[model samples]
Target chain A: MSEIINSPLLWKGAVVTLQLTLYSAVLALILAFFFGLLGSSRHGWARAIGRFYVEFFRGLPALVLMFWFFYSLPLVGIRFETMVAGVLALGLNYGAYGAEVVRGSINAVPTAQYEATVALNMLPRQRMWRVLLPQAVPLMLPPFGNLLIELLKATAIVSLITISDLMFRAQQLRASTGKGTEVFLVVLVMYFVMAQILQLLIRYLERRSERILGRRPRRRAATAIAGTTGTGSLSGVGGEGS
Target chain B: MPSSDTMSEVPTPEDPQGAPMDKTAADGALPHGSTPGIRFEKVVKRFGDNIVLRELNFTVAPGERVTLIGPSGSGKTTILRLLMTLEKLDDGVIWIGDRPLWHMPRGDGLAPANEKHLHEMRKQVGMVFQQFNLFPNMNVLRNLIEGPVRVLGLSKDEAVERARELLDMVGLVDKIDAHPTQLSGGQQQRVAIARALAMQPKVLLLDEVTSALDPELVVGVQDLLRDIARASDLTLLCVTHEMHFAKDISDRVLMFDKGQIVEEGPPEQIFGEPTEQRTRDFLQAILAT
Candidate 1:
C-alpha cells in the first residue's frame, strides 16, 4: 500500500481519475437539468426529443460509447482527445439517468406552488427559478449523490481509451510486480475512500439545502400554533383557500 | 333577481353595448368610457367534456365587494380562477377595466392572448389562494417585497418599506424575517394577503381564503380580510362557504349551482330571504353543518 502510494505514476493516474470524474460530473449535471426540464415540458415535441435522447444514451453501455467517440469518431473525421471522449461518454451516459431523477424531482414540487407563482403574475422563467426549482432541489440531491458515486466507479472504463486513470495504473502495477491481489486491493480501497468522501459532501449539501428551504426543525412558534390549532381535522380545512 | 340594485347591470346576450360581438375589432384601441371593474360576458369554460362555467355574465362595479357562495363543485372557485387568468376560457371573453383579459387585438380580429399580453393584463389583478401558497424559499419580508420589487419596479428600499407596512397591516410585523413554514396557517394566509396587496392591484380575487385555517385561526384571518376590505377601495371577488363572513364583507352575494348563477342579491336579501329554492336549500344545508 505504501509503495503504491509513493509511486509517481500511480499518483498521476489518481489525479487524472479525479479530474475526469469532476469534469464529467459537472457536464452530466448540466445535461441532467437541461434534459430533465425538457422532458417535463408542456410541449409534446420537446418531451419527445428529450425522451429520445435519454433512451438512446441510457440504452448503450458506457464503454461502447467511450470506444465509439474515441475510435470510430476519428474514422468519420471527428477526432477528440482520449480524455475528452471519455468525459463526453460518461457525461452523456450518466446524464440520461440523472435526467430522469431531475424530471421526477421537478414533478414532485407541489402543484400549488405553480399556482401560487401564477397568481403572483410571475413569468414562467421567474416562477421556475424562484419558486419551483428551489423546492425541487432538495429532493434531487440524494439521487444525484448516488449517481455521483456510480460515476466515480465508472471512471475505470476510461482506461480502455488509453487514458492513464487509477484503474489503468493499478493494471500496470499488477503486470509489473506480479502481485495482483495487493495491487487490486489497494485500488479498491482507494476507490472506496473516494466514494465515502463524496457521500459526506453530498450529505452536507442535502442538509444545507434543507436548512435553506426551512424544511429542517420547525420553530417553536409554529409547533405551538399547530398544537393550538389541533391536527387533521383543522389542518385539512386550512387548505380551503387553494 | 332579489333586488334591482344588484341586478341593475347584469348583461343579456343581445346587449350590443356589452362585449363587442364583432370578433374582428383589431384596432388595438383601448375601450373608452367607464368600464366595470370586471365583466364576464357569455363566458364559457370547460375541462374536457366537463363544463365548469356556462354563459356566465356578471359585472362588479369598481370597488364592489362580491362574494360567491355555493355547494361543492358549484363553480364558485372557477369564477375567481377565471378572473385571475389561472384558467382559460373555452368561449366568450373576460373584460378587466376596458380591455379583454383572454384576447388581444390582432390585425383585424381578437386573438387568444399570448404570454406578453397575459403578463400585461395580469398586472391589474391579484389573487389570494386558499392554501396560503407563500414561497417557502423566502422569508416573510422577501415574500411581501418580491412582487413590488420585481413586477412593480420598486427599488429595494422602497419595496422593503412597503413590505414592512403591509406586514404591520397583516399584524405579522414580528415575523418579517421568519420563513413561511415557521408561521401558523392563519399567519401564512395573512402573509399571502399582504403579498397580494403589495402588488397594488386594482382588483383582488380571494378563493376560499379562510377555508384552510383552523377553526380557531379562521376568525383571525377573517378579521384581517375584513380590515383590508374596509381600508381599501380595491374590487374584491371572493368564493367562500363562510356565510357570516360573506354577510359581513360582501356588498353583493351570488349563489351559484352547477355552472350558473342560481340567484344573486344584496347580502341582506340573499342570506335573509333567498328567492331561489336551490339557494335556500344550499343555505340550509351549509348552515346546518
Candidate 2:
C-alpha cells in the first residue's frame, strides 16, 4: 500500500488522465461553438452539414472511434502519438453532442431581439456577438457543465490505447497487491470524489450565472453551500429506473 | 381618395398612379439634415397577392408631428418599417433628405439598398416598437448606449452622458441600472423611447409604442412622447390606437384602409369632418367614447 502511494508511475497515470481530459475538453469547446453556430444558421447547406456531423459522431461509440483513430490511422500514414489519438477521438465524439446544445440555446433567443438589432442597423457580426451570444450563455451553461464531466470520465477509456491513466494505476495496484477488492474500491471512490467535486463546481457556476440573469433563487438550492450531487448529471439519469 | 381639400391647381405631376409600381417611394425623396427628412413619391408596396400601398404619397416637414391611424393591418406599421428599412417596398422609393435610401445601384441594375446605405439612412431614423423590444439581458444604460456606441461611434463617456440625459427625460434615472424585466410596461417603453432618442434621428417612428402598456400606464408614456416630440426637430411618424394622443400631437393625420390612404389632412380636416365614409366609420369605431 505504501509503495503504491510513493510510486512515480501512479502519479504519471493520474497526470496523464488530467491532461487528456483538459486538452480534449478545450478542443471540444471550439468545435462545439462553431458547429453549434453553423447548426443554427439560416443557410440550409451549413445546417444540414452540421446536423450530419452531430448525428454521425454522436451515434458512433467513443470506444470504437478510439480504436479507429489508434489502429486505422497508421495504415493511412496518419500515425500519431497515443495521447494525441485519444484526445482527437474524444474531441470529435463529444463535439457533435455539444453542437446540439449550442444550436438549441442560440435558437432560443427571442426573434424580437433580432428585429431590434435590425432596427439598430447592426452589422451581421455585431448582431451575433452583442445580441445573440449573451442571450445564449445562460441557456448554454447547464448542458455544457454536464458535457465537461462526461469528457472527464471518458478520459478513462484512453487507458485501453496504452495511455497511462488513473485506471492504469488501479490495474497496477490490483496486480501487485493482489487485492482486487481494495484496489478497485479505492479507484472507484476516487472517481466518485472527482465527479462530485466537478458537479459542485457546475452548480456553483450555474448559481452565479442565474444571479447575473437576475433570477430569484429557489428555496433549498439558494441556501446550500456544499452539496453532494447524484450521478444523474444531465437531467433524470440520476433517478432510479425502479 | 385624395381629400378634395388637398386639390391644387399647381398640378404636382400626378405620380403615374396606374403604372407598374416598384419602390415608388424610392424617388423624389426629401434630403436629410439639408431638408426636412422623409419623403414618399407614389410609393406602392405589396406583400405577395396583397397590395399594401397603392401609389401612396406623403411628406413630413422637419420637426412636423404626424400620426398615422387606421384599422389593424391598414399599412400604418408597414410605412414605418419601410422608413426603417426593415421592409423593402415593392414599388417606389423612400428618401431621407437627399439620400436615396431604398435602392442601391447594382449590376443587376438597382438592388435593394445594401446594409451600409441602410445603416447611414437608419442613423437618421429611430423607431420604438410596440413590444418595447428592449435587450432583456442588459441594464437600461447599456441598452441606450449600444447603438450610439456601435452604430454611431459615440464615445462611452459621451454615450453615458447622453444616456443619462435621456433617462432623466423619460423619468427613468432611478432605474438606469435595473434590468428591463424589473420595470413596468410604461417604464420599459419609456426606456425604449430613450433608446431611440439616443440615436438623435431626424425622423422618429413610433409603432403603437404604447398600445401594449397597461391602461393606467398609458398616460405616462404618451406624455413622455409628447414632450420629446415637442423639443426636437424630429419628423414624428406615429402608428397608434390612441386617438386622443394622436389628435393632441399630430400636425396632420393619414387615415389608411385596406392598405391605401383613404384621406389625409390637417388634424381638424381629417379627424373632425372626414370626407370619406370609410374614414368616418373607422374613426367612430375607434373614438366611440
Per-model chain B TM-scores are 0.88, 0.86
RMSD of candidate 2 to the truth, in angstroms, is 7.8
Residue-by-residue lDDT tens digits, candidate 1, A1-242: 66766777677888898999999999999999999989988789989988988999999999999999999999999999999999999999999999999889989999988888887888888788888888899889989999999999999999998999999998999888877888888888889999988988886787677668877642343355577675433322332222
The per-residue C-alpha lDDT of model 1 at residue B101 equals 94
**What is the two-chain DockQ of model 1?**
0.45
Q: What is the lDDT for B88 in model 1?
A: 81
Compute DockQ for each candidate against the true complex.
0.45, 0.34
Each model's TM-score, in the order given?
0.87, 0.81
- How much RMSD separates candidate 1 from the native structure? 8.3
- Deviation from native of the Cα of residue A225 in model 1, angstroms: 24
Sum up the clashes in candidate 2.
Answer: 20
The CAPRI-style docking tier of model 1 reads acceptable
How far residue A17's Cα lies from its native spot in candidate 2, in Å, is: 4.0
Q: Pairing residues by index, what is the TM-score of model 1?
A: 0.87
